[model samples]
Target: MWSLPASFLLLLLLLLLGQAPPSRPQSLGTMKLRLVGPGSKPEEGRLEVLHQGQWGTVCDDDFALQEATVACRQLGFEAALTWAHSAKYGPGEGPIWLDNVRCAGTESSLDQCGSNGWGVSDCSHSEDVGVVCQPQRQRGYLSERVSNALGPQGRRLEEVRLKPILASAKRRSPVTEGAVEVKYEGHWRQVCDQGWTRNNSRVVCGMLGFPSEAPVDSHYYRKVWNSKMEDPKSRLKSLTKKNSFWIHRVNCLGTEPHMANCQVQVAPAQGKLRPACPGGMHTVVSCVAGPRFRPPKAKPGHKESRAEQEMKVRLRSGAQVGEGRVEVLMNRQWGTVCDHGWNLISASVVCRQLGFGSAREALFGAQLGQALGPIHLSEVRCRGYEQTLSECPSLEGSQNGCQHENDAAVRCNIPNMGFQNQVRLAGGRSPEEGVVEVQVEVNGVQRWGAVCSDHWGLNEAMVACRQLGLGFANHAIKDTWYWQGTPGAGEVVMSGVRCSGTEMALQQCQRHGPVHCSHGTGRFSAGVSCTDSAPDLVMNAQLVQETAYLEDRPLSQLYCAHEENCLSQSADHMNWPYGHRRLLRFSSQIHNLGRADFRPKTGRHSWIWHQCHRPRL
Candidate 1:
């Protein structure tokens, strides 16, 4: 062997010791940074930075929109619309590597901004930052003519804005519903309602961050406009009626990300002509606000304690409210728990902590989906009655033999429908099975009434079953006269209620709006019988051990072994049947595992008898 230099010998020694080469640290500098968390799109999530071959979150202490814009631009986005403090996307773990970051709004990357130095932070991970980047509008379909006509400022699709109209004292915060306005040709314009439909309303509502469209009361708009014109101090007559519209004749399927994505005949062509409406009506919309639009408030005079802050938890990637990958916030950082030793007892604690019911199913192996974070707890053990997951025993360490793919998840038992008074099943033995009733406002009072059975069937009954938290529809009654005479029986409130058996509630089903039925329409009142269990017959296991025994054939066929009268005095009168054959005989107890009660099909006096001998004493 040839003699080597000291540096070469040292490198060889490191390699033999299972250590990476000097180039390993260089690769960490080029590691990819990404946004990770629950979001409807890629541009929104908790702010996480990749450093030293690990991903970490930024502390939200003093995190501002300027810093958010810098982060978004680093990720190749235009700008940030909003920055969330207090971990709106939930906290993160691994390392809260940045804190008290201050950006000048034009920095190229987060690294260039002022911060408390790498891996140094006074704040906890509960304050991890989140950002929602402004969505990039589509300018693909515009022709050269249209593009040129729009000029530089309007080159992109016109923006949509909502102007608040404080019409009544009932209006409050979070500002859900507003007047629809579109920015066109560098100016805001109101939409004309010539051909406005509910689908069109939905697109506008979605743009305004609302969940769905509500029935717009057009009469209210008429009243407001008339009131304005009738104002004595108002400059109504002298002012021009030449208000221009940005776009009209909108045709949307109600799934567009923005109003610009909808089919609309846009500006310059319409701007040149005097503004006019075919229906002479301005578009007004009412939107049903979603959960996010509601602001959270702390309890009166009760600040959150340190213990309360330490025990926060959340669920992510679930289709509904109460099912998803379980994330626990520990020591200010959010991380997942491993599925090892995880069970319904552990999962139920998580569900209850999140304000949901017990766990419907405790899923293992990351069934909901793998999360991108550290597995903070492993081999979690919990009693079935723990209040929070913090009360459970767990092995603490990110390196515990668990991966993101092995993250635990839970499907929690959630309530059926949100609009409780809108639909209900009534007058049955159990709360789950009953006549269909809905609360409707008559005159100025709320009254519970029946649903029309005109188009009602098993499909519609399925919706009722789901709304009532019943398993499924066992039967749908076309006529409820049998239960109509009961107390609180009333008129029909809905007609032609049809469903596809997949709606979360009966209110989501199709109907001819809300209808009123006169009293005595018993034949058209809807009713439902729901079942909590499947139709199954189970033999009593304990009875089989004692009073019951197995019976085999030939002699088994000579008498009905299921009847108690078998092996009676009639056996001596019978001719010797085919030569005696080996047989097993036993008494059994059959239990019905179904929604309906158990009843014998035949009378006790009608039991069949045949030749069979009782065991001799």
Candidate 2:
């Protein structure tokens, strides 16, 4: 230190420490940005820029999509879809920075764009900015939402049904104990007993909403199987047809909701392997379920106190038996569930709890109808093996966080009573709308025939539409003269058909005891135009909750929302440009989360010219 200069001494000290001198200095442009907010999606959050080893927020004084695009790209997103002001994500805490931002939309980085300068802003935390980035949909790459479903909890399996051979099993409400039958490709088939273990049975029992697995009386079921082999006409014989066994072996961890989650072995090639089960028989599973869920077996005419059911699940406001908006009871209050992360796998657990089959649709946006109640659950991530919704993992949401616009619903799979096979829609522009055809047994010979169009209404069509699993009835054609069909398929087999609209099948509806048509048949057959899909249109509830406000908008400003078709149909009647409205204004984002897309039925040839729907309705 006495002999050397300060620079030379520092260089010598750095070499002694095995370190190199700085080539360049780091700047705010190289600083990493961190998104922090309560948004459930990764592509959105409050914009927090870093400075002096501390994170701060960007003010929304002059922030626009151009600035947001550069910021979004800096945050690992391709582009910006939207930007919000007034702390849309949530108010941030820290120093205010980067105000009066002005970007040219072509900037590669937010730091490169012009701003008031670092730490120069006339804004508060309440004016923090946020952005929604364009979500990545690149090929060969999965989104965060879809990839999340590939977990063990979100995995799915084929539907399982129980055939109760024991008399006691038939008495149980949910059929606690029975011979387990696995549905393979829409056909119910028996599982092979070879190498079948209690763990596999345990998994099946869990899927059926039972508490645990019980022992199966193999000695009794073996006798029933032998009887079917010895005598083909035996009632104890389980197989109704020449059912083929497709699954030879399945190994379960006893924690799966369905058999598909575990390791499975497929039976050898069909023709090569004559008997798929080899030396094995059909598998059986008995589950442990108490009488708590069953109807009370009280003394004759004894009154029982109807205590409020707790920790239970129910469906409400459904037009049919096996479909409704899902509700759960907790803390002595019945509440609805948020549709976030809701899917068919989660709905199947609700269906199994209610003694029904798998789910056909997981509805959203109060598809069945909205209910007035607290939303107790959100992000209901079901593993499908849970006995009830109470067993499934869910977040307790607040009333302000969730709304009826996001209420979850389900359409469950019911038993096929052969009603669809008995009823057919024939001769139309499409399979959904056509001249009705009914199968009639004429002296033991079944033939497809027509129906009398007299008195056919929407109520009658509702039953038929549900029976066919085609959804709601859009129209009931009184006359089908335009329908083209074979003359032989025009015999009037059914007449005087009356329905309350709650019937499950056409057989349940009241009809003429003997076929009698008040009007002529053939082209006059009872025809119906049924909707193919029951679409669940869900508005962005969280976005609405975070950004909602009652604003007295000028008539001119309302036209932007109206022209975008975001306003309700009632807005059409309002005299635009003459008066203003106190509208519940927000950024609207409605998405079709249902299994099918929403296709309008009205066509250019039929729709009135009040509103122009481009590219045909």
Which of the numbered candidates is closest to the native, going by highest TM-score?
A: 2
Residue 360 in model 1: lDDT: 47
lDDT of 1 at 393: 85
- Score every model by TM-score: 0.29, 0.48
lDDT tens digits by residue: candidate 1, 390-455 = 778889746566887677887664432244446776666766666788776667788777788877
**For residues 204-297, what per-residue lDDT tens digits would candidate 2 score against the true structure?**
7655555367787788888878777678676434342343565658787665544565666655554573666765677888876522334446
Worst 10 residues of 2 by lDDT: 299-308
* Model 2 lDDT, residue 472, Cα: 73
For model 2 the local lDDT of residue 432 reads 79
CA-only RMSD, every prediction: 22.3, 17.2
**Which residue runs does candidate 2 get wrong by more than 4 Å?**
1-190, 195-217, 220-246, 249-257, 267-279, 284-321, 328-335, 341-346, 359-373, 381-395, 440-445, 533-617
